[model samples]
Target: MLIETMSIVRDIPNLNQLSKQRLDWLLAIKQQDFNTLAAMCYQSHVIPYAMIRQLRLPKSNHYEKMLPSYIIQQVNIKNITEKDQVWLLSNFDALVTTQECIIFCEELINTFNKGRTPKLILQLIQDKCLPTQNETYWYSLQEKTKDILKKQFMISSYYELTAISRILSHENTELDLGFEDHERRQIHSRTMFWSNYSSRFNRVRALLPNEIYRYIETKLKRLSPQIECFDQDGNQEQSEVFIFELSNIIVVEFLRGELSETRFFKNTEWNAKRLFDDKRLSSAAIREMSQMEVHDHLSTWQYFCEKLLRQKLQVKPNDNLPYFKGLPPAVNTYDAKIGLPKPAHNFLSERALKLERWVELFWSAEFKTSKYGHQSGLQLKSNLYLSKALIAKQLDNYEEYELFIKKAANQGNPEAMWQLGKSMLLNRKSDAKIRKYGEEWIGKAASFGHVEAVELATRFKLAFIPYKVSSSITNNDETDIKTKNMEQEKAANEGDLDAMYQLGRRSLLKKGDLLSDRLVAERWIAKAAILGHEDALKLAIKFKLPFVKKK
Candidate 1:
């Protein structure tokens, strides 16, 4: 009779819904009949929690798989045992659906509020469930859980802020907007978001209460001392990167109007009078000064400045700005004479002056301590000089621009060499001697593997020799040239675009039969063009190679 009943129950379509026969069959199975009960549960597609507990069935992998469905379908949160809750929490990834996980997390939080162990809830948050196709819903759930953790002091405010900043950064789809129209719209939206502080503040207050705001503010206020501690404890480099990101957030908030000038200034002063005295320093300068490490930090600051400048000037993302390209704009144009409008001009001027002061401060310290022995100090000095030169060019201060560029170039800064060389070559009234000097500078820059300088040198038929190559090896010069050509040929065959371009350029520059040289140059340059080398593509088009059709 029991076997006949089990067969009947198996034929039913909705055995997952508990019925009288299913319940009776489960009860009728003796405690020793564990296999029979398990079989019934498996066939029914349900496992009643009470029956499993009473029968002392082991929480096997099979049971764990079935448990999620049972919890979602039948278990009462209030009556669920701690052991079962632990099992459910531990196997959260086993939940068949995101909806099921969401339901379980909400219930767990409710349980947490009603005197359950906080550690369990915290652990659940730490082991976040796998995300689903619905990224928006998943990110929302993550933020909600993090907020709960923040409020309960399970996580630090700094941790929460970092998480929030990361989320915000991901939300900006600047890179994903591939089309010009979409990019413009995104930039406009970003501009609006940054310009409207009141709306931003209101949204923040809506999501996080005033107390949380005050807590974050207090933590930020105390960050300076903590950074100093990090420095003293030999984590200076790490601390400097941290301060760069932190100050970035603070400055962004101030620009957005979420933070007042006083609060922003207080948080970023870094005990530097040049930053705050008479408000001479721009926000970017102040932030730059607050950092301890000089390496790569200037590049970071420059990138940040570009973002801000794009927004302020409403410049399209792809608009090739001369400032960033290390080339000053045409003489006396709107950009060259005054690279920025009045407001941007004032900002950049302040920033340039502040950087100048930074170089002076470092020089003074080095002189006092006799610490000029380190290569890093000299590198830092060169980088600072280069930065100052770029700003001076933007501000149209030609004398200061030349002064700083020469200083950096003298220190073997390749970029400064390229810039100074390009400036000299582009000068309308440059004498033949000046042009020769400029070509030498460009050749030096090319030896340093400067891409643009190499392209420029190639166009001018200059030899691609390394700056360190000894001129006294007159007897072996031809042999060296042959060896270098062989190496370049090997690299080109191995698919190096730069090598291909160099070989093509060398072929074009050769004093040989024009027809044969043209074919050789076209063959190598065309290969590079097919591989997406920009200069190679241009050169290929200029040569009118048969494979390259005119647009």
Candidate 2:
């Protein structure tokens, strides 16, 4: 199945392999409706070009980026074949799409002026290529306005942000309505809510596919919750990567949803994950976020400055087309900059609540929100306490750090159990005390897949070789546990329900991420649910994990 999924993505025409893989995972889960699938494919198709533009800004200028469009305009190859033009339009490059859309609209206007309205053909193109609402959203199409709606929808469709910006900047035949700008106003007023084409996705949550939105959001949860500071061990790379990944994810899954009510920090890596346990600190974070971008004693684009710059930096696909007939621009390959977030601000706008939760745990002494607040949706994740213990120690609060470590151990955190046990081994005065507590806690940790705990327990005569400590194996150290994982893999490959049950538990160790690959882990757990692994089944059902096929 995995190989089959890989093959599906590999066959996509021009997308790079990495992008194809990302899009494949996002797209492989069949939605049952081809319209939804088409929307997903279209979004996935557009993001690479969007990312390329974001990446190109730091080192280049507008002229360099506009090179592609300039060449197309200048080269006047009057006898270009229709087949060649179709291929050029289908390049899937943002700049190429923009130019083609313009040319297409112009040709349509010309044909209309020649006394022919290809309404059927235009309607098909609008239905397929335009960014549009899901069919369910249109409550009713009035009999009187249906014809006008079609025309307005056609004039409203555009290929890129650049296209909209260009059309709005000045008068052009493509944007002009029979040489009058009044058509633009009429098209904007005719749409359901948007006053402009670029604003179509601004309120897209209503049109987004529910299942895909939840799925991508689940992935986003895994990537978020990192701590970032400008000078310290900041999460600049992770935050940047996340912003890039998220924009692509939303466009493909959530339809470029709004951020006016979301955390503004979503796009910025600098001080992104700062804790605001302190009131002064919370105020400080808000102030920093509120501050506008400044350049050499001048306020430029204000809070929007970074977003503007990145859009400018993106590599335009104008001259890079193969048919242009020249060595590719000296630099700016799609590989060099595409979908990387230099500045994450274009996608952000609300206050982050995650850091407050981190701070809540950070202050073990406070122990606020004793059993978890339902409103916050914060849960005690596996190894979370152990991670907090490490942070506590870093803050030099060793006294409370031990307390936090023990808390994690009590919560069945394998790392905490193993670590607390190791600490006892070194600190306890008597051998009996050392052996008693050390073996107990480490044994518990070993049951959850702590390899070192397994080795330690084995050396202390508390466990056997291969460490099959649970009814389900936990330690996944291939060297020692290879036979078991292989056996499970074999049984799983052959569709053995019992094997899936065991593998699911094994993959679901609450000790560490080293044991967790949520997609694979969830799949195993979901498979086991069919065989009735009680806890695994509960979570699988809750998460709506995909059920694997039986042999």
Candidate 3:
């Protein structure tokens, strides 16, 4: 049955493979359709049997990183036709399908944009898989695939697949309509979260599928019995059925209660295990998790932003589309930037409290230290600042919040500078007082590689926002000049788009007795402009400069 199932998939169009043994197995199998082969591969223990017989686990825990071995089993090229091979090559990428609202894998229907043959397609996917390390070569393969999808296939659909891949990889798939660049970063962060989360679960002998969300949803809907438990001290606390729904993931958290520890089993051949196991979680961790849950609300905000941005401009994300450079800002400083705080809505506030309770329970510090201790000084100061800022925001005290921002910014926190910049830039009046602080905040944040800061500074041509420049004496001092120069140099090395624009403007306008090489400054600014800096775009159009845009 296994051999017959494998054979059908081997013959499926766009399923690239060739091995004599696999061909023999295919000839032996009775299955003839791609769907049947896929079903057999999924339902039977064929792949698991192959893994046990043919492969050894790597020294490290590679189970979580493992791929389905059906792809790795030996195959024969003699039976595969040239046309069949071409079809396989054309549809080499994976596709996601749904059966009765349950997600499953299906043969990807390729629209051959890359012009690569089936043989080449096999080589590409193979190249993406390393002999040893799993993280060895992901981005490069993703980039190559993205290029092909953009130039040849339907770009939009390709992006949807990419997004699906992210969810499969258990990465955050927050789609941001307002800020694509900002949201793309969260995807990487989500990948990190999954890696860490899986590693933690693996230590306790808990077997997890690659896609936890989909698996959990399917299992619960099928009435697969799973047990949940809480960890307290050493002796087993209790366990209960992990009854959850497919709609929302809130079921995962609904499992806390008192029950006797006992063995339980269901229709599926599986053993019950403790949800958290013997792992001793801390309160600090719980707090951080709670904070993250709060932040997850940003996903909805991101989706809305994507819709708004796409409608305002003819931009489609899947086309490997670079952001527009010279297009007049549809979203300007005047746009409403804030989202409603969860505490404002009663329903949201209830959920927030539950998440917060879990966080505080898991992350409570076991010990406390004296405030006067030198080791605790920095921690104390930062905490004080954080507490004050939180209070100010809670009371809707913008003035106090602004002061806290200045204090933190002066102490060199990029996040503080970013907050300050946002506040001043959004204010209606735009007072001299606010402008001075805002420019200072923007430059400081930009110098440190803050994304929003870079955006703001480049949009407005402010060289150095006049601030309380920390110094021994007055603003005219040489030390201040040296510091500013060093800051600019550092920012330039870090590829600050606004810094380049500033350099170009200063070079072109040569104010004071200060002089810089015109050619070098022009080169820097032109580079920035070419890379989609708004100021650079405006300057390029103004001076009628000629330069090709870098991909």
Name the weakest run of 10 consecutive residues (lDDT summed) in model 1. 198-207
Candidate 1 vs candidate 3: the TM-score winner is: 1
What lDDT is reached at residue 140 by model 3? Answer: 25
lDDT per residue (tens digit) for residues 1-551 in model 3:
76536646565666433343345333423333333332333333244233223223222223211222222222223344555444333223332122311111111112233234355444543444221234323222334443453344322221222222243323232332222444344433333322211211211112122233244344332211122122343433221112211111111221112211111111110111112332433222222221111222122223222333234322223222232221223321121233112223444344434533432332222113221122233433543454355435544566777677667666666667777777787788999888787887788777655545655676686554423323444444555456666766666667766667766755543324234476666777788888877777766665566766677
Best by lDDT: 1
lDDT of 2 by residue, 1-551 (tens): 75557656667689876576455433433322333322332334332233334333233333233333322321113444444334334332344444444444333333333233344434534543343533211112222222244355542222212222222223442333232354333222222111221322221211112332233334221211121122222321111101111221121111111111112222222222222222123221332332212111011111222232235322122223322111123321222124122223322211112322544443331223232211121225434566557545533558868887988888767778888888887774648867678778988878756756765665566752233444333354333456657866776767665566557655454335453465577677787676555555655655567664334
- In order of appearance, the predictions have TM-scores of 0.37, 0.25, 0.30
Candidate 1, which segments miss by more than 4 Å at Cα? 1-65, 69-350, 353-387, 394-398, 406-496, 506-522, 542-546, 549-551
Error of 1 at 358 (Å): 7.3
Assess candidate 1 and give its lDDT.
0.47
Q: Could you report the Cα RMSD, in angstroms, for every candidate shown?
A: 17.6, 25.3, 19.1
User: Residue 106's C-alpha lDDT in candidate 3?
Assistant: 17
Question: TM-score ranking from best to worst?
Answer: 1, 3, 2
